[model samples]
Target: MSKKLIAIASTGGHYVQLSRIMKQANFDSNDILYVRTKVNANDTPSFENESLIEDVSRDTLIRSPIIAFQMLKLILKHKPKWIITTGAMPGLISIVIGRLLLRKTMWVDSIANTKQLSASGRIAKKIAHKTLTQWPDLVGENVQYKGRVI
Candidate 1:
């Protein structure tokens, strides 16, 4: 059997954090896909081999069916077995779609010093196969602490 396909974050802090995890996980570079909203022309070399998708911002994320449609397309194209994220809106959409498709999904709430759980983390708890928090105390029964991604 082939190794499962994995999707990782694409931009901002989420992308940076996910990149570290992916490196540690030593996931097959070809089997990993990356999704991000902002693409800097100069940063193209960073994601040369992996599949890439633009993340839709929070304000327009769920409000637009296009975002959902795009997500569905990626899910179909990649057929990933695991979807992991760092609490971004587009990443949340991927988690939800992966769940609906019965894929294994992991959502890691961002470790930024915010007292509240992120919108992505909250929604992911309701649907994801696992909700991992960097801070053990903030997690409820539905969420688990998986140590800091950093």
Candidate 2:
């Protein structure tokens, strides 16, 4: 049987963290697609099973709608069994929409920044099928501490 499809993160700490977890999953490159803000213009590495979206910063009002449309398109096209992310604007939106669309969702808060739970992590606690936190003590009843991402 084929492994279930997944929508992975695209850039920065979230991307780095997600990449680590994805390596442990049974899914292959074709079984997952990446949704990131933007591709590094200089780093032209061959990305076979990835897609990019404009990175939505907190200051941009238009970020949500653009990300929503892109996420909707990817959800329709890929039909992933689960959507996973680390807290960030785009990740938060993806988790919410994924739940609404009946896709299993997992949110893992970044471990490096152990100081606080992100806004996305808080929202995910309310809606995600599973809210994964790195800090055991920081996890609430709604959240699950799944250990460090590394």
Candidate 3:
């Protein structure tokens, strides 16, 4: 069976950046899957396999457990070999689950976060197998500024 690649784009810009990487890498919808909010799913109709989750942020951290449950279900169902995301709560949960499952995980920090890594990305840097920053200056021991999504 082909290994599945998972990505969560919680914001509009994050979705666009993920889309760019999908196209740049010539990944078909079948080769990869998406986890996003309902609005983000509506924004990008190309990917057929998508899991829509409740959007949560640092301000709305109270909903993390619910979001985490949803992430767990996706991980159990898809069994993705690779997990990736742009900074956000649901994305953070996915990468954490991915790491626990021994899946290769990557966090591509948003280009909008030029000064520092996004909050979710910062957390993912500790758990994810690889964390990448869009800006060169923000590279750290755990987070690396390799290439950009946009």
Candidate 4:
């Protein structure tokens, strides 16, 4: 079957959170395309269908264009119907490109953002098909308080 979902996140906590959700999501392995930030030479993929993008953040604006290009390429190659993230910057970028491709997108704000949504998450609320916060207190009209990854 063609992969229908592009599941993305940055490294560390974001990646861990996304991984946890994917494990419980019960999506067929063949229908999922996982994406994560490329961290190091040891960054071997855990899933059969996975891609890595250079790690970039707001502080690294110069690198964003590169990431955008990468996201576009991946979106074109995978042609996923849905894009989901437990994000930092890369995942957020993926959602933007995926949305431009008319793909459905979901953003799960990191559990670490207990006080507020991450910068990327805040933007995602405006564009993503669904935006979820781990903390119930953070939920509002556009953001939902789904159970957390942690």
Candidate 5:
């Protein structure tokens, strides 16, 4: 059977937050496919079912389409029942595609965003089924505070 969930995030803080959430959520690693950015040689597989895609951001708008296509293919290939992410551009892209495919989607704003939601998190508030912030003060009608991941 296809994986039950797709959990994605970019490198650094985003990936760290995703990892902590995964552990706390107590999901079976075998049932989730982890998607993260291809940062450097130091990056190694953290889970048996995982894939890495090129990292792109607002500064690299020209390549966003490529990242989106990659996410689409990844999502289609896995056919996950749900998609959850800790944000950066990659995770936001995955949520969008996951939603279009009718997959349940959730976005957790990085804990690094203490004062406000990140750009991707803001947009995700509109696209994802649930948008969460680590800071309770940042919560709004579209976003919920789920406590800190760090």
Candidate 6:
């Protein structure tokens, strides 16, 4: 069987960043899967389209549990060798689920977060196999500042 790579991204900027990495990584389409919202899915030809909790802000906290469950299901079903994200809620949850399954998880905090880590990135620091930031100043022991998608 082919090694599977699961790339998760939310709408807008998150999608742009993840898509850029996906394009550069050049993994075969058959070995790649995307966990994204309907808004962006119309453009990327994904292998699966399960409903994950949508992009959320501080006020939309109630959706976290649902997103967690959905991510758990996806991870168990696909068992990807690597799980990557340009992130927010869903990405963080997938990292948690993916890690629980002993899968490698990477998170590239959205370019939007400059001074501080985004909500998901903060949580990712404890769990993800690797966490990347777009801004150099934000680099730390566990968090890294890798070049951005561009």
Candidate 1, after superposition: displacement of residue 60 in Å? 2.4
lDDT of 5 by residue, 1-150 (tens): 489999899988888889899999999888889889988857777657878888889889788888899989888888999999998898988888898999999999988888889999889999999999989899997999868888
lDDT digits (tens) for residues 1-150 of candidate 3 = 243888787858887888787778787678677777656535554446776788888898999888888888777777788988876778888888788778898888889998888877878889998888989999998988768766
Compared to the true structure, candidate 5 yields what TM-score?
0.93
Q: TM-scores of the models, in the given order?
A: 0.83, 0.87, 0.88, 0.94, 0.93, 0.84
- Worst lDDT run of 10 residues, candidate 1, spans 41-50
Which scores higher on lDDT, 2 or 6?
6
Q: What C-alpha lDDT values do all the predictions have?
A: 0.73, 0.76, 0.80, 0.89, 0.89, 0.79
Tens-digit lDDT string for candidate 1 (70-94):
7778778777788888758777877
What's the C-alpha lDDT at position 81 in model 2?
Answer: 89
Instruction: List residue ranges in candidate 6 displaced over 4 A.
Output: 1-3, 40-55
- State candidate 4's TM-score: 0.94
lDDT of 4 by residue, 38-91 (tens): 889677777679888888998997899899998898888878899999999898
**Shift of residue 20 alpha carbon in model 1, Å:** 0.9
What would you estimate as the lDDT of candidate 6?
A: 0.79
Candidate RMSDs in order: 2.7, 2.6, 2.5, 1.4, 1.6, 3.1
Off by over 4 Å in 3: 1-3, 40-47
Instruction: List clashing residue pairs in candidate 6.
Output: none
- Please say which candidate is ahead in TM-score: 1 or 5: 5
Clashes per model (N, Cα, C within 3 A): 2, 1, 0, 0, 0, 0
Ranked candidates (TM-score, high to low): 4, 5, 3, 2, 6, 1
Show the colliding residue pairs in model 2.
37-55
